[model samples]
Target: MITLDLTLPDTRYPIHIGHGLLDQVELILPHLRIPQVAIITNDVVAPLYLQRLTQQLEKHGVRTIPVVLPDGEEHKNWQTLNLIFDALLAANAERKTTLIALGGGVIGDMTGFAAACYQRGAPFIQIPTTLLAQVDSSVGGKTAINHPLGKNMIGAFYQPQLVVADMDLLATLPERELSAGIAEIIKYGLLGDIDFLGWLEANMDKLRARDPVALQYAVRRSCEMKAEIVGQDEKEQGVRALLNLGHTFGHAIEAGLGYGKWLHGEAVGAGMVLAAAASQAMGWLTADDVARVQALIAAAGLPIRSPDFGAAEWLRHMGHDKKVESGVIRFVLLQQLGQAVIQPGLPATLLESLFHSPHIDPALARQ
Candidate 1:
């Protein structure tokens, strides 16, 4: 087990990454303010993990309330959030009742938001079951549900008491979902670590094969990078925004496609390619650099081509991005393969040209 601490200005939490963590109830025991917890999951994850987690906690004399929600990004909304409230209220849950998210990103986000709103505030823990969650969403405190106007527009930065990223849980993850997780891991490398990026390039095959050693190293390194950035700017006042390298465009894809159409990581995969092309246009990256980005994304089994939503429609959707300031949409663009910069007030013509650019076309990217 590799344990790392995410130290914030006021508080810190331990991120436990290993196999068989779910069996170690003692890890969770210390973080609980009370002996009761609400395990929030989805229908898909509940059958696989909810019962086992519940059994483990119950054996320790902890009361468990399982709230199973519908799965999918489309269901992440007011109606679905209220389901958690209903379960908690019926069970007489209180501020001391810790909410344990036992699924992937959706479950974690809703559970954290529920805890934050429940009785003004309550403690929560994250047991992220998906790769994307473990590497990114689970570490950072950014929790949210998708809004029709924007993805994650309505949400809060509510840190968890602890994060348990059990590698064993990923054994059941579907291939598509596994590929989705790799997108975020690749993001960490692309945004900052050149050596890690090279490592990923060399080990993409091993990662695809689900080699345990490679998985552990990837998760640990991704968590370390996120922890460092988040600790420095917990509220995204500065450096933290760099973490959204592909998110501004990615979020627009999610919302414009009506949510759940493309998995978040898949959208991010294509979005990163678009960002790379935009960088090329600005003379920050060469065409070869953009091709490398596209190659890596395709190698990971993710889409390199973004849907042609047209520039006007694209802007309409992206206008709701959280990174916008003073009505100017801020983009996290690449200055180089291993570096990122936040830029605003990009030329309208430049954006329009990229919108119609062959670089974003599926046929060209595929070729």
Candidate 2:
């Protein structure tokens, strides 16, 4: 196992990346200094891996309580989160009882939120099953559930006690889901590391095939980059927003289509294309820059064109995004590869025209 330490202001945690790390769950949990455990998983994940995880906890002499939620972004809401709290309460789970998030981003975020709110707060470990979760969501302590008005509008900045990413679990991921994770990995390269992006472009096929070394490098590098960013801005006051490069438009897509219509990474992939294109149109980025980014995102098996949301609705959705402040929407646009700048005070109409522009082939847009 490769372990990296993440040093946030008031908290320190380790990110473990390896094959079969889940088998070492017992050794992993004790470090969190907890006496009891509550695992929040989903029906999809629990049926396949729950028995082994439950047994492992039992072996460690930790009393285990499981709350299995229905899996999907749509199910990431107060109702499901309430059930987790109710279950923990029924189990008499205490302030110090640790919560193990045993699924992807949705499960991790909801579990983290539950731990944050349960008895004011409790420690939690992230066991991210999907690529998006492992590389992006799980490591950063950004826990959230979807709001009726916006994606990730209701959430907390609650860090995990530990983050264990078992690459073996990704073997069972569906092809589409695997592709979605690749989008975030590509983001790590595009937003900060040109060398990593070059490496990804060269070895993407191996990553798609799930070769262990390639997966490890990608997973480890992505996690370390995020850890470094989070360490610098533990509460996302500034600098951390760099991580939201594609998220503004992505969140709008999620809200417009309804969450889960497009996987978060998928939307982010497309959103990156628009942000890049917008950067070009604004004359801040060259055409070659936009093309390079578009090519990389397309190579990752993610859609590179904006979906066919009406211009009016898209404007309205962006208005509801949490990043909007004082009625102005801010966007992270590319100044160049491995470079980004946050552009603020953009009129929604300017963005709408950019997405609707003729330079982009509307033929590629999703109906």
Candidate 3:
């Protein structure tokens, strides 16, 4: 097992990553403030992991209330969030009751938000089953439910008490789900770690094949990178925004297509390519750089180009992004490979030109 620490202004927590970690209840029990807990999972993940996890907790003498929500990004909204509240209130959970998020990013996000809002606040732990969550979403304190107009429009920055990432859970992930996670893993490289990007290019086949060593290194390193960034700028006051390198474009795509239509990581894969292409047009990145970025994303089995939502429609969705300040949408753009910056007030004409570019491949757009 490998352990990493995230020290922020208001809190400090450990991120534990390894195989079979979930079966060891001792690791989780110490983090809880009380013996009673509520677990928020999804229908799909419940069948696969809920029983075993519950058994482990009960063996440790921890009482649990399991709330199994419908699975998918579409379900990440006020309606589903209310279900967590309903279960928590019905169970008579108190402020000290820790919430255990036992699924992928969707579960982790909603559960964390619930913990943050319930009785003003409560502690929570993230047991992220998907690669995307373990490497990115689960580690960071950003928790949110999707709004109709934008992805993650409703949320909080509530940190988990501890993050228990059991890589063994990934063994059952669907192929597309696994591919979607690689998109976020690649974002770590694009945002700040050029060396990691090279490593990914070299060992992507091993990752895709689910080699244990490759998977472990990918998750460990991704967590370390995120922890460091979050520690430096916990509230996204500055450097932390770099973490959203592909998210702006990705969120726009998600909202334009409707949430859950395209997986978050899949949209990010295509979004990164668009960001790179835009950088190229601005003379910061070369055409070769753009091609390399697209190739790497494609290697992970993610789409390289997005459906052309057109400039006006694209702007409409992007304007709803949380990064927007005073109606000006801030974009996290690449100055070069592995270097990201937040730029706002970009001219609308440049966006229009990029949208009309032939490289976007209309044939590739999903209809």
Per-residue lDDT of model 3, residues 20-105, tens digit only: 99898899998888899999999999999999999999988999999999999999999999999999999999999999999999
lDDT of 2 by residue, 57-133 (tens): 88878889999999899999999999999999999988988999999989999999998888899989999999889
Clashing pairs in 3: none
Candidate 3, which ten residues in sequence have the lowest lDDT sum?
A: 358-367
Candidates 2 and 3 compared by lDDT, better number: 3
Question: Which whole-number lDDT from 0 to 100 does residue 89 have in model 1?
Answer: 99
Show pairs that collide, candidate 2: none
For model 2, what is the C-alpha lDDT against the true structure? Answer: 0.85
Cα lDDT listed for each candidate? 0.91, 0.85, 0.91
Sort by lDDT, top down from the best: 1, 3, 2
Candidate 1: give the clashing pairs: none
Over all chains combined, what TM-score does candidate 2 have? 0.95
For candidate 1, the 10 contiguous residues with the lowest summed lDDT are: 358-367
On the 0 to 100 scale, the lDDT of residue 166 in model 2 is: 93
Give per-model TM-scores. 0.98, 0.95, 0.98
Model 3 clashing-pair count: 0
Give residue 79's error in model 1 in angstroms: 0.8
In candidate 3, position 246 carries an lDDT of 80
